[model samples]
Target: MKRRIAVLLAGCMVMTALAGCGSTGGEQKETETGSIENKEVTEKSQDTGESSGAEDTISGEITMWTGTWNDGLMDTLLEGFYEKYPDVKVKFEYLPWDGMEDKYLSALQAGAGPDVLDMAIAWTIPYASMGKLQKLDEYIEKNQIDVSDYYEGAVETLYKDGSYYALPYRSETMCLFYNKDLFEAAGLDPESPPATWEELREDAVKLTSEDVYGFGLCGSNAGNTTAQFYSMMFSKGVSLLNEDMTASAFNTQDGVDAFTFWSNLYLKDNVVPKSVLENDNTTNRNLFAEGKLAMFVSGSYDIDPIMEANPDMNMGFALCPGFEGKTSAAQLGGWNLGMSDTCKNPDAAFALMSYLASPEVSVDFSSTFSSCKSAVDNEKYADEKLKVFIEAINYGVPLPGSPYMNQITDILYNEAQAVLSGSKDAETALADAEASVNKALQN
Candidate 1:
């Protein structure tokens, strides 16, 4: 499956990119800094002057752009939008994900973008900081929509500065998956997986043989490396950045310990495949399925591919192991919806957004874990294995909302790779990474 907004033009409405980012007739004002200031009235909401401030007044059309992965669900998801505001027209197109972020970046600079954009969780904060996204705090408060209803990790990614830019949409978490047969063969309990980092290492050592490594890790400079590393650091109580996010948090002794542990898994232990430097998530997944690896971490979506690759292989999964005495923490991944600052109909756009985020609709759009808590009641989610991931959501957290996320990912992975390759030790690597990341964040 396929995994993975701009400024507004003046009174002249322009539909250029993503088949036109949702923007229509509305008087526009651009300040000296180029931030759009199209004041939207509160009275134009769907709330009937009660819980939500409303009226049939919420009219006008909004254009939304998202990836084609949700192609068929578009109609089902928009059902709430159509019913809530009969007068408002909803227009959307699913674009390819490969260069979609670059397309949005270009569109924003040219002052032509969508009104409602379905953006990656990582992009929400950057866009909000750029004033490209219309802040939803006012709309959320007025409509009495509760943000607490969503997953905490997904919700964490939408905030920048003091305001949150988007509503949590789809959320997924990675968990530890193991081959039950392999576990039994290694004299380990097939039913009980690793509960802490020490246990994981012990199990990996016992499970490792000339042919099969116990655990798999990724080091390729892709997004998965950052995901895996951050998950490890978080589980061990290490944060990527300090509380204010001003400097590098990984330069500290705690970060050194975590990094050492991660690097040792490959260099010191040699339990992971030698292809780690070139490996990515897909590589590990395939290795695990091929019985070359006994354990790995990934999202629920990998279940199908593994079963398809080796139907007879017995599989078992559990929460990612925590550092000793700590709760399991996962690196949260998801998408969210945000309104463009240039959208003419704030009330209409916000109404549609709130509707889509409601508990009922969230389950429909979410591919893995719905941000809504009540979604567990859905019979499709009754599988016992999924419960492990759902529990993981409790401690999961998102990556920093830095504008330099791409650079940050590269530095994070490259430094770790340096340690793994013996080019640098853990202390030197983390210190160098700390300096580089701080410089990148400043820009």
Candidate 2:
């Protein structure tokens, strides 16, 4: 996918519009700024007659390989989806996170996969490039869907080779998760979390103790590693690739500094876990919940889990810290609703995808920020901690659209592992990674 990445939303602040699709018939209202708003999405909108004849005509069962985040959304979605397209039925298959992507590829490659895939943004292009996903531009256009209603970063995930292959669903951004109780115990102000990289490091040092580590890292998994380190690199005002995506840009001094700082937390500062080189985000989350890790970088998905792990723990959330004079960056991350190239019921599938991805439904489905900006007004996100995540989205940056994204992550993290393990200096490790990733990109 040819994504127009980077800080593309320098001017567009809060999105005033929203969107719905398929047979829904919500009205567009005008905002004070003279912007047309398509924010409402009632299942009964079909009665308003704005729906396409195809939605009114399509029928039969369509399958969706659902993920854990479904959160009972399928029932809620079906009530509306089935109501709009009464003849269409949906079958959902919940898949395990481990090896889920490979399972998806195997099924699609074998031409026996579900009609729809609840895809991650990172998976969209890879699957589309492999001819496993169905193009979505037609469905979006035919349904009068408003693409501009979503965050620019969210919209970028759908485009590949000049066509959209999926529709944005949940939007995500990483943030700082800390223990308020630990902060207070460490003599730091519990009400205020670190807002800058310098402060984060200083406070982490103070919070470190015999039984608790101050901070954590996603040590092993490449994707998890990037979720932490790449976020820091972006906040330091850097990109993994230069403007043209032809070579690695992470060898820059800021990149090295970010990597060095992360490694030092383990090797130099000694404020991270002893197994810092092996922990993934999940491992860190468990540690943090068990009162072993005082702070860590993670997205909203962990909020509930933390509370569940220790109901009495005083956890707090903060925007990811930035440099003194740079934009905070969280890897723009989220899932998208995608269709299989081998779908037997394209119309029914599109209708189902449209209903589920509609702004109204998506907000409920998003564990983090909803891809639809209108969600800011939803009371479900009224909690100050939840709002922190919504605010982070404004600073989020899209991951590179390169097909080598996995390899790029692997090379950078593996080399950084050398630095963390005391086998190499950060600068040298970064340089080697830069060269390795550049070679991967060339292929």
Model 1: per-residue Cα lDDT over 385-435, one tens digit each: 788777777777676665665666678778878877889998998889888
Candidate 2 TM-score versus the reference: 0.81
For residues 179-247, could you state the per-residue lDDT of candidate 2 as single tens digits?
Answer: 999999999999999998778889989999899899987677666776677778888978888765678
Clashing pairs in 2: 1-160
Q: Candidate 1 regions off by >4 Å?
A: 1-55
Q: Which stretches of candidate 2 lie over 4 Å from their true place?
A: 1-54, 68-73, 109-113, 243-246
Residue 154 lDDT in model 1? Answer: 76
- Count clashes in each candidate, considering only residues at least 3 apart in sequence or on different chains: 8, 1
lDDT of 1: 0.72
lDDT (C-alpha) at residue 347 in model 1: 87
Worst 10 residues of 1 by lDDT: 14-23
Q: Alpha-carbon error at 43 in model 1, in Å?
A: 27
